[model samples]
Each structure stands twice: as structure tokens, then as C-alpha cells.
Target: MEKQLSKKIKELVLGFQINELTEALVYERIATFVKDEKDKQTLLRIAADERCHAEVWKSYTKEAVKPKMGQVRKWTLLARIFGYTFALKKMENGEKGATKAYDEISKEIPEAKKISEDEDRHERELLQILDEERLKYVGSMVLGLSDALVEISGTLAGLTFALQNNKLIALSGLITGISATLSMGSSEYLSAKSDGEEKPFKSALYTGIAYVITVTLMILPYLLLPSSMFMVSLSIMLLTVVLIIAGFSYYVAVAKELSFKKRFIEMAGISLSVSAISFIIGILVKQFLGIDI
Candidate 1:
């Protein structure tokens, strides 16, 4: 007796089949761009699995299906810009959602269960092999980005009202930012040395450089815009802080398999709250001290 698939089952099978083929193309495209031979080979192997999985689905559907080329291109571009690790991990995460559907479908076709298991294994192996230099120095990045968001937000927010002059605000921010960068770099080096970590110099360099770049971005509006727009400059700096937090949080979430929403909310809350408090303090200090510069 030839088993029959209903319209709903046919739709589901075709959808997953297309997804598998799309993933294969994405992996193949990324592998070509990767410089590391070992990483490239691993990606190729994953792509092979994806192709095999699609073929299995094709047997059930009994129709030749093309991949979703749009998805394949989107992921290929993402991998090129953000590194293959992040791209692959994000794809694996998407597969996790599909696993539930596979489980439901397994009742009708036992092969679906096997495919789900293979997906789980792929994710496990992918994580084991996914090694990007950016992820390696995540701690340094967190320190640099976190400190800059907090320190710069508060500094700019307070100085926005305190100084009331864009030139003075910009000058003060640059001076403070430069001094803090030096202090943070030195502290990082000393701390890494104390911990017996490899390449203390590199760690310090990464931290210091990340911090300086962030500070530069935050103070940029103040430098370029007119003095009357100091308030607007502060607003821009605050917006920069949010973007920095969101960007870093998203990268870490994808790379490390963490929660982007939770991390982002916590960081934004803490940094913004500090800025709010410091803003009030700045007003109080300016009024109490009678210092108008």
C-alpha cells in the first residue's frame, strides 16, 4: 500500500526540504570565503549533511524541489561580514525550532526522527568547531564596551547641562576619555599578568583600543556640531550607547548562545540609570557650586 500524505503534511515536508537545501548552499558559499583550510573543510562536511537531509525529505515528497535562494544569499552575505561562526550558529539555532516540527512529523515517517537527531548532532559538533578570534577576546570587548557605555553616557549626560558649551564639553570629554583609556589599558595588563593569562599585552591592547573607539564615536557629535547643539550632542551620545550595547549583545548572543534580550535590557538599564542619576547630580553641583564655565 502506498502511504498518502495529506496537503498539510506535503506542505510541511516541502518546507523542510527547501530549508535543508538552502542551508547547504549557505554553508558551501561560506566555505569558499573562509581562509582557514580546516574550518573550510568542516563547513563543507556540514553542507554535505544538509544535502543528504534534503534528499531524504525529497524521497518522502516524491517531487524535485529547489532551495530558497533568497535565504541562502542572505546567510552568505552575513557570514562574509560577521564571520562564519556567527552565521553558522545562527543557522543552527533556526534548526532548533525546526526540530519540534520534525518530532511531530516523525509519527507519520520515522525518518523524520532520525533527521532531528542528526540536526542535534550537527549543532553539538558545530559549537565544538566554531572558533573565531573575535569570540576569543569577548571579555576584553565586554569590558571596553560596557565601560564606555556607562562612563561615556554619564559623562556626556552630566556635562551636557553642567558646561552648557559644546566646545568645553567636547574638550572635557576628550581629556577625560584619553586619561581613562590609559588607566584602563594599564589596569587590564596588570590584571592579566596577575592571572597568568597568555598575551597580557594583547588583552590590554584590545581593551584600550575598543574603549578609545567607543569614546571617539560618542564625542563625535560634540566635536562636529555647533555649541548651541550641545543638548542634541548629548542625545546622540546616549543613542550611541544604546546601539553599542545592542550590537555587542547581539554578537555575543549569537556567538556564545546567550540571551540577547536579557543581556541588552540589563546593560541598557544600568547604563541609562547611571546617566539619569549623574544628570541630576550635574545640575545640583552646578547650581550649588555657582561655577558657570
Candidate 2:
């Protein structure tokens, strides 16, 4: 029974080592394919780190009383067959899951706790790298789109309110929406190119396209509604509420150090403040500038 338990443990260790190697390979491929210089550097660093972890586990496997060499080669080949993109996503999911698994298993296997800690650290590092890389792309895309959507939507809504049933309100909304989409898309594309990072042009272009699409989608309702006393206002309020909820949820998820309630309240407060300020400015521009519908 004792021998069987030792064999089982050795197999588990070898399985984990194979996973580390697979992750290392995935990172290496990502490092090679990534065009952004910063992202490339980060991937290379992570690959190197994973390689070191594989070596550590290799050493442990060799020194163990009952060595169990699992299907490492087979698994590695299978991962390669799946292609780099799928493999990378798998590695990310595996790392995240392993972190939680390690945390749970550490309570029972005190001696293996060190290994678990190492896995946890590596998982965290990988997650951080992913988050940083995503921030560079995702945040910028979302910001450009959300900014245009809210600004244009709010402008059209306010104009409709002040105009008191002018058809020009819908026309202005269309003009602003198109202009904002073009301007924001161009700005995002240029900014991405200007960053001196060699990102996959297709990826960057897609992100820009997504930004434009998001802006257009958000502003479409305003244009679709016929000139009414309150439909535009209702649509604007609904969009604003959706944005607030989505934005607050993102803030809470990413704000690691802050409690959810605290982050929610803070983000909600800031959003409300910004909305109030924009509305007041809109009113003033209409009142003082004497802009005609």
C-alpha cells in the first residue's frame, strides 16, 4: 500500500511537470508570434520562467524514490498538433485552474505545499502578463468606443430635449455618430501604429473596428426612434444605466485591493458626477452660445 501511494504521488508530480513543459512551449511560441515588442518581451520572459519551473520539477522527478514518467512526450505532441493559439488558451486555463487546485491540495500534503506555492506564483505571474497585455489593447478599444458612444448619445439626447421635437435632432445624431465613429477609429488605428510596437496589424485593425461598431450600436437607438416627446430621453437614460452597470462591474472585478462594495460605490459616484457635469455644460452651451436647432 505504501509503495502504491508513493507511485501515485510520483505520477502526479510527473503529470504536473509535463504541464509546465507544455506551458513553456506555448509561451515560447507566443513569444515568437507576438509582434508587439513589449508583448514579445513579456512572453519571452514568461517562457524562460516556465522553462525554469520545468527544470525544477524534472529534478524532483529524477530524485524521487519511485520515479513515474507520465505521457509527457505524447501530451506535448498533442498540444502542438492543436496549434499555438489553442495551446496558449489551454495553458492559461490550466494555469488558473491549477492555482486553485494547488491551494486546495496544499492543506493535505504539507510537504507538497512548496510545490503548490510555486505553481500559485507562476499562475499569478502568467495572469498578470495576460492582464497587462490585454489592458494595452482591450482598455484602449473600450475607452475609445465608450467615450464616443456616451458623448454622442448624450449630446443627441440633450439636443432633442432642448429642441422640443425638431427633426434635426435625429439628423444631428446621425452626423455625430458617423463622425465620432470615423474619428475614433482613425485615432485608435494611428495610436496603435504610433506605439512603436509591432502588433499584429490585423488584431489592431479588428480592435479599431470593434470600437467603431460599439459606438455605432450604442447610438443607433437614438436615430431609430421617431421624433417623440420622451423616447429619446428614455433611450439615453437606458444606455447610460447600461454603461454604468457594465463599467462598475468591470471596476469591481479588476480592482483587486478594493472591496466590491467600495469599488462599486466609488465608480458609481464618479460616473454620476461626470454625467451631471456634462449635462450642465450641455445646457450652458445651448443657453449661452445661442446655438439654433
Using lDDT, give the best candidate's number.
Answer: 1
- Please, what are the lDDT tens digits per residue for candidate 1 over residues 196-247? 9888888888899889999999999999999989888888888988898899
Which window of 10 residues has the lowest lDDT sum in candidate 2?
63-72
Query: Per-model C-alpha lDDT, please?
Result: 0.86, 0.55
Q: Which pairs of residues collide in model 1? A: none
Error of 1 at 189 (Å): 3.6
What total of clashing residue pairs does each candidate reach?
Answer: 0, 1
TM-score for candidate 1, residues paired by index: 0.86
TM-score of each: 0.86, 0.50
> What is the RMSD of candidate 2?
8.5
lDDT per residue as tens, model 2, 1-293: 22222555556666666766666665665566555677567667777776676676566576423212243344345344533333344445445555554544445445566866766676566545443344345546545545654565456556654564435665676677667766666666677678765674544554556555654555455556665644555456546645654653444244222355654555445544555665566677778988755
Q: Model 1 segments beyond 4 Å from truth? A: 35-38, 99-104
Residue 135 lDDT, candidate 2, scale 0-100: 38
- The residue pairs in collision within model 2 are 35-198
Most accurate candidate by TM-score? 1
